[model samples]
Target chain A: MTKYKINLILALVFHLKLISQNFNFDSDIKISEEFRYFFNDPSFQGQEDFFPSYSLTPKFNIKFNDNNIIFRGFFRHDKDIRRTHVDLREFYYQTSISQYDFSIGYHQVFWGVVESNNLVDIINQNDAVESPFGNDKLGQPLSKFTYSSKNTGIFSFFLMPFHRKIVFPGKKARFRFPVVLNRNFIKYEKNNKKLKKDFAFRWNHYFDIVDIGLSYFNGNGREPIFNRNTFMAFYPMISQFGLDLQLTFETFLFKFEGIKRTADLQSFYAQVVGLEYTLNNVNGNGLDIGMISEYSYDDRGALAVNSLQNDVFIGTRFNWNDFSGTSLLVGLLSDIKYNSQSFSCDFSRRFKEVYKINLEFQYFLNIDSRELLLPFFINDHFFKIELSQFF
Target chain B: MKKIIVILLLIQTLNLFSQSNEKLGFEIAQKAVLMDQGFKSLSTKLKMTLKNRNGQTSERLLENKILEQVEDGDFSLIIFNTPKDVKGTATLTYTHKIGPDDQWLFLPAVNRVKRISSSNKSGPFMGSEFSFEDLASAELEKYSYKFIAEKDEFKIVEAYPVDEKSGYSKRVVYYNSKKNYRVEKVEFYDRKGDHLKTLRYEKFNLYKEKFWRADVFIMKNHQTNKETVLEFSDWNFDVNFSRDDFTQEALKKAGN
Candidate 1:
């Protein structure tokens, strides 16, 4: 342990030396505490978790003449399933030369327009233990080269080396499926050596009122197929093609995202189409309300996880446009084939200059037995509040 | 008969003078827009303080970079630098002279760029007293100018929004009558013709002896009794920027 600590300090010093060579440097640190109140008791024993969790993240950025570097790290200690862990969210060196931009190291890429599901955002693995909603992702290591044109479109290519696997909540956690995911017993459809070298490409352009993107990816699938009891996680070799489109009119936004993936076990297609319409300054009170609706469909029937075979999502976002920076979003997702449904609400407000407060609540209702992973999360509905201070 | 003829001639002269005055108002507005052009690019740091009716205050820091389009409206980027929650957020706007502007917002938390279709341009900017329309670079064709009055050293001009979608009925702009022709103040009237807001430009500093910029701008909303003060500093007009710097892909990296 002493040697490990010494080595860690040495590595940090080396990184500091590399950063000091830059011209201008800026850094920010944030600390947050989250408290969750579970209205429902854990269905099983030993599942009762602590009420509070803590997280600390420090971000650093440096600019060297024409080159830029940014690094962010996250460290969290929780009483529930994840326990304690540290992750490197982003550490990349980027530069733009002429019409091309390049970045090498750990990074994240977000693609697609549909709000309900991001079918084309498959470059990074999900950090499921961070949030039950699956909106968090682990950092991915890749070398990216992008070309942007004034009149045409932007094309980006990524050569990714190494794959990060998704982690699930432990048995002692709440709001998770009953099956305990064993990270050790992972399976790969192809040899690890071959799967390590993955490639992805995307082209995005805007024409008049419409914005569109086409993406192609060949890599180990981000989602793992799990079997019962042993939690046999299988990372299959897959190839995917994706299309995302958005059309913005006067006060309405139309969006669509679709993907076709071929894997070792099954070939499936999925799509989500949505629209958002805003009523600005309703009643002349500086309140803007946006209504959103989306429909999701997957061809893989009940075989797919999360019961996303067919679903409809409806949500509303309200912006007070006040000095407090108040905003609220409420959404609901219902399974078309089953009676399972999920309702969530997120409200946030900025306090003064350095602090922000957020309240989030999610409830899963009427879980049909036919829905996959429903049995374990029967008592996972809860409300959480968090405060973050930035320095 | 001689007296009547003299009166008719007087009326004719008055009519011609009024017509010329209207033409002069348009010419002055056009001249102001033209004089401020050819700067090529400008980058500045801004600090905005928003105060409500109850005197509660909040502040946000932003960095703005503008690249002048040779033939069209300007392309600009605004990056939020302070106010912890909003830090790392940025917005890119491409303003057009003939039509509505294109705007995209980058949210750091989600790491996604959202295309906002806000053609109305009347929404408050970041909950401040200033509206989105006010933040955009002024274009001469957007409004029709009519000479209102001359108060001391300032020439007041009334500008009517030509676009039917404008939330305001008209705007009254005050310009410095001097050769510099910089804006001095502005007053906005709502759709119902009520006085909505008043903006005052203070502490003018001439850069390179040709370009004029205000060091302080204060916008006061009449209806809500709220005010926003924008203080600008660290103006750099020579830092060269290209079209590549204004793309949506560059927004995420703009925090640096």
Candidate 2:
């Protein structure tokens, strides 16, 4: 074992001894099931009319003394015209010490992004078309260590070394393992009037709202450019600098974030900026409205072979507490240059605890006429219904 | 004919207006309480993964059963899969959901079941980072609530725990107005009634047109400075279970 591991083990042993004398150990379990259906447009070719997906996820958690641990595993089975069987989704362990904490195994790590639209998140496994861009691969191991200094500030470092596999339909893909690292440091000032207490170095604040970060990676996971003979070379060295800012005045909440990524070549640099604002109470009935927007620019100050892509989105939500508590949400996304549009709506109703029901609808428009643009603009409609009971 | 049609339209409009007055928050809390009352027994499969400080990981799987009777607040039996240390372990609680949810654990290694006091409920469950409070069914009636605001799609409410010994003193809940029974966000308060954590629910789905469940639940604890994100899928409810399944003999027979 490494020195760090030895130290950790010793500390754990000491703590466990103390806990066994004063506290007791306990355990719990949770089980869940999910069913999904997908309908594709027949005109799109090689599309299926109905695709059903099911998953069973069981979770177990335990605690001793002041220390706690969690473990969860996910299994997915899909029945479409093509595939059927159980696929392992995720398995990981997480634990914490005084000011230090760690997680390892097949886990998901989310960092620096508005809805995970930025480049910092690497463990995203969402397959929904509405989800932001991210990669999900198995066999990737991630570790994160964090420290806090009470009233001063907080800092954390995250590292991951793993093999990334990219498989295309009907073809064997490529695989590469690389080392990735991310570091974040944040400081807060006292705002007694707005907050109950002055800003202090704490894990919850530091991990949830990272103010400053530096990220870098070295890997050879580039997609093959020409039939496994040629590969597109990405700058082996990439670094990003970013910050998150929040402003709260009266009942209004405003948030702004920006991130910049630099590569060896000027053309490969990327920058993203995002802003959101929510106004409380428009009319009576407690109606509030909010707007969110983000913009990304790539290939700045460098020669580029393709045109720059821009994306913009806006949405609003309305809630009514009366009438058994009902909620409604609608959002729209538009690719200005490509003239593509996506719209979604969600509605829910809670009847006295016996049952609750929710419905969602989404539509994606395919506007690209060129075959090259089809990959990014496959239009489709999606719908889902969910019901749950408390017992 | 025209006069009758106009009268019927007026009555329908009146009914809609009356229905709109019932707040979403109130409905959700009411439903939450009802759901907690319907269960007589439960059976589930559990998988646990442990990650040590050194990054080594291990996983284990087991089956669980619980038999409950609410009239006397008696937990007849709780059983676990058979294993040398764990098999045939059954617990019977004389009084649960009262002052202290009394519990007992029967360990095959000792050939006896041990009583668990109220103080022990705060301990971790298994080797995971969850506590007994997290495992227990939250009683909606245990808290009093006030409607705070109605946003574009949800009604936000604040609930104050009536039980002094409850883990949290206060909570803020956001409910979907259209569905009138879904929770979007829940903010938990510490013993001092200070905001300590926030739990957000997303990806709501309607199952069997009777229930609405969130696919993801992210809990951020402020006091301890930790976060737990639960992404749940494949939810099957109403599976048949019996009191015999929760017996110690059955647990031992199953082999933990």
- Count of backbone clashes for each model? 0, 71
Candidate 2 local lDDT, A83-109, one digit each (tens):
222323334454545445555555443
Q: What is the interface RMSD of each candidate, in Å?
A: 1.6, 20.6
**Tens-digit lDDT track for model 2 on B1-256?**
9999999999999777545433444566776545545455555554444333444444334454545565535344444442212333555443444444544455532233223333333233443334445555554555677666778887777776665545567778877756745678888776677877787887887765656667666666665554555555445556454443333223322322
Cα lDDT, model 2, residue A108? 41
**Lowest summed-lDDT stretch of 10 residues in model 1 chain A?**
A176-185
Poorly placed runs, candidate 2 (over 4 Å): A1-40, A43-45, A81-95, A123-140, A166-242, A249-267, A281-287, A300-308, A319-328, A347-358, A370-379, A387-391, B1-256
B88-170 in candidate 1: lDDT tens per residue? Answer: 99998888888878888888876888888857467788889888788888888889878878888889888888877676899
Worst 10 residues of 1 chain B by lDDT: B247-256
User: lDDT per residue, candidate 1, A1-391, as tens digits?
Assistant: 9999999999999878776765788899999999887888887777764568989989998897668888988888888647466888889998878778899988877998877788889898878788856577888999999998757778999999888876767777786655565665577778876666789999998886888999999988887776655656688888999999999997899999999999878799998999999988775656889999999899977666656779999999999887778999999999888888989999999886788899999888778777666667878888899999999
| Alpha-carbon local distance difference test for all models | 0.84, 0.45
